[model samples]
Target chain A: MPAGFSAADFLYILPELVLIGGAMLLLSLSVLVPRRDGLLLWTALATVAVTLVLVVRFFGLDVTAARGLLAIDSFAAFFKVIVLLSAALTLLMSAPYLRVEGIRVGEYYFLILCATVGMMFMASGVELITLFIGLETMAVSFYVLVGFLKPNPRSNEAAVKYFLLGGFSLGILLYGMSLIYGVTGTTSLAGIAAALRGQDTSLVLVLAVILVGAGMGFKIAAVPFHMWAPDVYEGAPTPVTAFLSVGSKAASFAMLLRIFVVGLPALAQEWSLLFYVLAVISMTVGNIAALTQSNLKRMLAYSSIAHVGYLLIGVVVRTERGVAAMLLYLGVYLFMQLGAFAIVTAQRRSDIIGDELKDLSGLSKRNPLAAFAMGFFMLSLGGIPPTAGFMGKMWLFGAAIDAGFIWLAVIAVANSALSIYYYIRVVVFMWINQEEPVGSPIVIGPAMKVALGVALLGTVVLGIYPQFLFEQAEVAARTLQGITAATVVGGQ
Target chain B: MVETIVFYTLSALILGLGVAVITTPNTVHSVLFLVMNFLCVAVIYVVLEAEFLAVIQVLVYAGGIVVLYLFVVMLVNLKRDPEAHQDPRRLSLVGLALAGAVLLELAGIVVYSYSREPSAPVAAAAASPVQGNVEQIGWLLYTDYLIPFEVASVLLLVAMVGAIVLAKREL
Candidate 1:
């Protein structure tokens, strides 16, 4: 209806458009194709391939095509790559499970792609409403995916709990947004920051900031707001759990980084204190909770929360190095979390549907490769040397200490030590703990094998050659200079 | 005077209905109350002159999502009310304490703010010549926010498949 609004703008968002188009195509193809499962897998693979290329192409391009609301900077580009890679890997891991469970359908891939797009957009969102919409997109998709195994009462329970909690969080988030809008008279993050410049602290403004922080804290599964995670993780399909633990959480962190570092930098002193408290609480609670969990998935769920706490160390610093470290940690975390989940999926035999502690008993004797991979993943998660997890923690905690958060770093490092015990417990269970075989060795599918290999390779490669990732992170961090400007404006 | 009346009325209705949505005995009734609450919020949006958002509040929240809630409620056919029996003694005391604390806090803030005159509202009359409503939202969505938007659509697609896989009689 307006001039200058060309189809070319649509081209700028080609990756997202393509994903939507691919989803629709898959929906129809599932109906047309005789073998729905094969068609779904192939379609999903094709969609991801196209999306990967688009993301790569968009990443290098210096085009900010969305009227300044949606940035196409290297920062967003880096996250786009991360989310897409995670989506592709998750889909690969999911295919085998769907096939085995005889629940293969077009919607599974479609939802995964949709959720990935949401994650990608969340990373690039410069506006509040856009970020909220993206978050909802991811969340709504997950609500369904978590309950995808509908017949299972546990799955249903998981989905219902996740949905109800997610809905409540959304309300809090929206209310917070409304308050922010009421104060700043704008929904744009930049506009809010600019308006808040030179402004004195008001009761309303303080409340708004706290509310927004609380809302985001819930999304990131920070302690006191992480109640839904363990149940959801344990109940959802293994692949969906992997996506939730890594993809969704990482996307939220992207938003958190942008909001705190770029949009509300002036409140750094205040929010950083809140983050410090959260980081300590999340790590302690998550680790302590994991220690008591017998279920492997639930343990991993709590561990993921603790990992979020560790990552918050980077946020507390609010420096360029801190942002860089956060991104690197997320990149490394994707590998470790997904790799560990893949091992869990691999351990699922015909009789057993999950990697219970008992299921992994004597895994070293039966499936030594899986056992070793599992060990490596656990070691990496524990921040053991020469693993991606260790390097990620080093960069993050190192940045915290560098920014004068020496005490926070000390606590995080201590928690990292506490974590080693539990992570090693899983390793010990697989290698040392002995139990009767419940079923024969799991028939590992080719796709899952490749997915595991990629995840493993990423962990080791990033661990060994950290420079490439570091440079990429540096570039990403540079784009976040706007955050400092935002914080100064909002804080005053 | 009219604005004050409308704001207070809408706020009370929203808060009341919101509580009802959560606390109602019948699950279906709770969902209905939620729909009512959403509608009231849409009206409040209208009062705020956010016409686009108000309409979306009705369409997405009231029409679409609330229906989903109703569907779940019906499908589940929860025989016994989940919160039918609140431990009367403890529950009522907890509720009373919460209400009292909230009221006290609200009163304090109201009293504190009563002294200061309301600041000049920003951009009260500079209606943008360019229309920026839902259409603009869509325009921005297709242009700048295209990738994430499309990704959201894909997520919905995946959700559909997942739902079918999970809900179907036999895969």
Candidate 2:
């Protein structure tokens, strides 16, 4: 073995390999199978299920693969499972939505699988280069997926804008990575942390940190770096938007915590201050912008940005409880965000785009079930009591308070209150505003129902009985804390 | 002294070409300037003693990517990219503020570096191993960085498939 490397290292990424193999198989079957209905969907779902099981096999593991380039720990495993679940949910909804869009390509599922695989890598990657590559994989798949609707000029325009802006942000990210490498002479997070112990804060390092923040700010759709998000969300195929909101956002948060907490714990005060500003501004801007949107997708996009801001409060806190709070919030967020988008996808038809708020008017009359699910998601998103969103927000803000950041908790609470207005507006459109008839009788396919059920169950069940999720999130966070503590001590 | 002058001349040329690539009004001229920029960057790689990197940069970036750029330019068949919509707001003050921020950051970096003791040890730069550049890189790629290398290949595969999916006329 070269430098204590073993073949067993490949065992650690077996789940990722399974996903890659399944993706290739999907693309190949697209060519060879000569099939049409539900074949790709079932296969993609099977791949996700298998990958999820494989990832669960690594639960509670705390080993480094390939000599610390990737972590195979409970922390990674937790994010991987959540990411895979979201991937499965996205695919479940994609069947009917893809049919409605008249796009039944095998490459569609393949790209989703590929993006999932990329996120899987992102959750485990311990090195900057690995994380960047994983980030690119997810980003590129989205750029193409956003434009999957070729005939629609809006889709084309969104794809171009996303590609250009995504490319620019990746450049900024890489430049920051290069600067860090220049200073530390290593690309691994632990290695960089080890090198920078007790070092004086320098301007170059500050610039590098800010650039990295800006780059990741684009990924998570924070304010001032969030110009591309609403347009991309509104223009993308609905399923893609759901996956982008939940899957991409969750994975990027994983990478963010990985970089900041697991690596830069020595500079906690500095980054804590930086993320404090990021949290406050993102919450205020995202909620304020969301209130004025007439388009449901655009509203959800801004709402998702606000949700991201709420999640950033956890990063600002940077304790075991904080990390656990983020994990809990993201878990519930996946369900609620995807559930809302599922309704949006169901409303889409051949004639009308059906994303306008007016399209949702009188939805309760057309389909009370869908309207009810949408109501649950909206309430959860607004952080009302007894919803998963509320439970998740409580833990996050509670952690902030415990960490002596009471002001942050207060700001987050105020923003959550402001956000309820728009969330309730969606509900009011569905139920109270009965004058405007929904143009057509809405149809809910079995696949979409399953997807919605999964999300609804997650949002409602986790909210009411969250002990299981709470315990698991703490175990996952414990591993992260252990590793960072070891690194800090070892470095000194 | 000679190396210093050479490095500065190449850097200045590369920066100028980069500016021209983005600023020039003509699409074809812009692409050709990009090609020149790539070539100059490859030369810089050679100057840094990474001959393999220089060759790869020439082959991949200057040769391969430029062809793709030309293909896009030809397919689009536009003299210049048309602006679809302009922001109603004239925000020159915002631009000026951003420029000032960047300038201040750069000055801070310069001043901080200059104020440091010249003999302060740079602990991060490990002593280079006595091996050929290509050999060292290859050995590391196959061993220490094998995972990232594999991931890069996967990324390229995605880009390839995505390009085909987006480019082909049919679904």
Candidate 3:
């Protein structure tokens, strides 16, 4: 509390402190008090809501704390809001599924909170070691959440596969960090940018970029590094799967942008080119792969990968509008993806695994509102008009084409068209399949109704009126530009 | 001259004790030999002036880890040979080849480091304001890296809680 970390520095990370303290309290209360899951859920939700308020309060502030290791700025606030919103939704969706599946909700909520804290740190951290720790914190929590249903063998398998792959990629990421540190002689992003400014790119620098990119690519489930995603996504609890796809992917993208744009702006040419290939391959492979999956979760997994590919196109353009486009799409994706997963959560019955395409049959006949929400989600995910997904992709690809990458935009549109087939498949199953339901009519809990209603509102309204999202995204993206121009140094 | 003799003498004892720890017929005796080996390693660390590492080597390896190993040995009580179940597709020869490759690589590293000229010390390391190595570590962990250090501790806490939850029979 004396020179380096003062009382005021704690004010900078007050949101994280609240989340971590809340998570620890939840875990402790679970152990001591035994079973008060409803109480714990309310507490967890309040904790996230409080943290959300705190993070949003810092939206326009450009402040750094912990001696430049953490920066609570507009960019961080944007992603922190995304992570917190998804965590809250995931918590809401988890209650009903846990009750139906007979899993404990206490540790489940704690894991979600802990992972949220990790993502917050990932967004705010400006130093490599801090960011890596943040990454591992989130990853380790997901690994446990994935394998949470101990009696289920598929969950067990998914946990092991994810842990092994996650640990290996962490090592590669650290190796890249070490190489870059050796070259630039600093772990701070601004320091690295300063060190590498006007310098000739070397082989080791290129290798470091690739290794770091690949490690992040795995987190985001990009092509060639996404072998574990389908299995892990399918095996994980449906709510956990939703959180992983949305929160983890967004946090990883935040880290990726910080490293590439803020840290290595001097070598943007190298990374943009690398991500160009990854974007093309990831989109093509992910969309094409989603076509054949019978299980709804696996299909969404592939589709999320394809979405990341689209997001990468925004990164490739490297303009403020491009970054804004990426931010805008991720913001919309938060709603559509989670809205889709909420339906899957609702469909989970006692006797039946509700993720199969056939499980969606007769849903419209059973509950028309849920059926409509599912169809709306699927249409949005496919980038149809009058939805947020269309606006997101339009701005993203429009930015790419505006930057003179007409071919990239064309390929992207073609892929979006190809992606429609699978997206329509979900709608077709819900709306067209006339078979009786595999299980009884789904009875979504009050909490889940709130989550679904929120997601639905976000997807529909954000699409119909994109002005609010665009303005916030433009502000956030421009904040990153400000961060680059002066480049934070010697925080005192 | 005296330090050299002591270093070599301890090194030989370590190697010989390591071999005996593996070959001994009795589990208790093997564990005792392991403790002795760990103690010798700690002594070597002390001789090299890494007092913190030496203390940690004794406390963690010799004291804590061996106790866990001993507990496992006591509980498992393997009556049959542990290696009796050999799979038909076991690639022992391939494993041996890989081990040999690693050994060769280590030898290459030793040869290369010894042959190469020692570069001047890195001038870029920001000079630590603290004096001692341990003090510097403490200072940094408490100050400059306080947030990261705390986050890492939280990581460990989550991992511990998660492992327990996953292994729990009932909540």
Candidate 4:
């Protein structure tokens, strides 16, 4: 154990403790008070809100606790806030949808909280073991969440495929970590960096890097490993899909950035090359495949993959500016992506299979507000001007150019243009195209409206004025820079 | 000479049983072969003087997990041969080729590392006050890896809840 570590170390993780404790309490209360389902939703939301507050309170804290298993710093706090925001919004949006679908509410909320707790842990973890546990905790919770609709055979199929593939990727990740352990004899990120500096580049270490990349690539739904995303996203409940697409993806990127930037910077050349190739492939594949997707959920899933590719370009730059841009982009994505999915949830009705693109036909005629909101989100996602998405893309691609990766910046620009086609297709469907509505008029609940309203406000505000969020991201990125500097000094 | 002979015999049994488990047509027979393979591994562990690990191999793999597999196989209907629905694709060939390449790479790494060091033989250390293998394990788990140990328990609890939620007929 590191000197001066004690039970007080738990205080550093108070937010996560509150989340888990609240989840278990809710799980038990749900059994005793099954009739008051609304109470469960509020309880879950309050837990997330309190955790968010706690995370915000620790904005500039720089401490490594649990004997360096976890590092509580600005980076972790930033990601935690993003995750908790998504969780709180998801809970707010879930109530009416759960009632409409006739699914029980208590366990659903419990699982969501647990998944958020896992994401918090993943964001905070500084040691390989801690990171792995956090990854599994989140992954396992999501497996259940994806399959929550047990009566739907499609949901079951998606769950099985996701669980099997997730478990395989996790195995590969652990193998890589074990190999690193064999080489460095330590599981701590700082220790690994200290050991790796000036060390010979062995084949085993390269293989470890490749394996780790593959595992994380799957989590973020990057190409060649993204076979599970479309099916799973389409099959899961819309709210759950929204959570998985934004919350889980953001957390995984947080973990990935930390590992590559802090733990294995010595192998930057090798991994950056890998990420560059992955970025191009993911962007091309995700955009091209999405062109043919008629299901709204499936299209969004592919778009999410493309976003991951863009995020990778940020990671590829391997600089504080690059990481800050990525963080800023994720913050923007949290709003626009969740807003898009919330609109999808609003389209759900007993008679309607809302995932189909045709279900959105003549949406402008029936519900102008929803159609406008959806159009705004799609435009933002396409990186059109005057939205968070465009500014984010600009910052990210600019970071690449600044780092002298001109070719990568060019590819990202072309990919952004390619992505605009699909994103605009959704807009055309809502605005220009007219098909006879097969279902009744979609009713937008207050909860769904609130969710969409907040998302819209965030998207528009962050777009025109990104300075505040960019400053926060810069602070977070600097915390990581401090760690790498320490590792370099310690290694010497 | 006797130790080498015993080691090779155990290795052959383990290798052959592993192959039999995969190749056998009957599910029950395949499971039996797996049990035999597990027992052979336990014996090999004993041969390496890891009695505690050997016992765990028997208890966990041979006794518990294999029995669970047996129950699952029996409960699920398998009247038709599973191979009848085989959808052989080009991907399978690519998968095989990749697997072979990985195996070769692993072999090369092992050989290169071994030749580089010719590692010195390890000497047994003095026993702790706990004395027994399990006791020592308990002590170390509680003292050195207390966080991970507790976290594992939490993981199990989450898994338990997940299983019940996913498998239950109704909420």
Q: Point out where model 4 deviates above 4 Å.
A: A1-7, A486-492, B1-20, B40-54, B79-140
Q: Provide the DockQ value for model 2.
A: 0.44
The sequence of per-residue lDDT tens digits that candidate 4 reaches over residues A310-354 is 999878887788889999999999999999999998888888768
Q: Residues B1-171, candidate 1: write the lDDT tens digits.
A: 997899999999999999998897778778867877887787777666555677677768877897798688779887746564656686578557644643553344335344545444336223323344445566656755554565555555555665666567765
Candidate 3's residue-wise lDDT over A306-337, tens digit each? 99899998778888888899999999999999
Worst 10 residues of 1 chain A by lDDT: A483-492
Q: State which docking tier applies to candidate 2.
A: acceptable
The top-ranked prediction according to lDDT is 3
Per-residue lDDT tens digits for candidate 1, residues A1-492, read 343445666677778778777877877887788576866887888887898897777654444556556777778888888888888889888877876665556767767877887887788887887788788888888898888876678889999999999999888878877987888787777777788777776777667667877888888899999999999999998999999999998889888877766666556677888888999999999998888778899999999999999988777777778878989999999999999999887766556786577778888888888888889999999999999999999999888877778888889999999999999998888878888766778777889999989999999998898879988888887777644442322111
Candidate 1: regions farther than 4 A off:
A1-4, A60-63, A482-492, B13-168
Model 2: pairs clashing at backbone N, Cα or C within 3 Å: none
Model 2 segments beyond 4 Å from truth? Answer: A1-5, A486-492, B74-130
Off by over 4 Å in 3: A486-492, B1-127
Candidate no. 4 TM-score: 0.88
Alpha carbon deviation, residue B15, candidate 1 (Å): 3.9
Arranged by DockQ with the best first, the candidates are: 3, 2, 4, 1
> Which candidate, 2 or 4, has the higher DockQ?
2
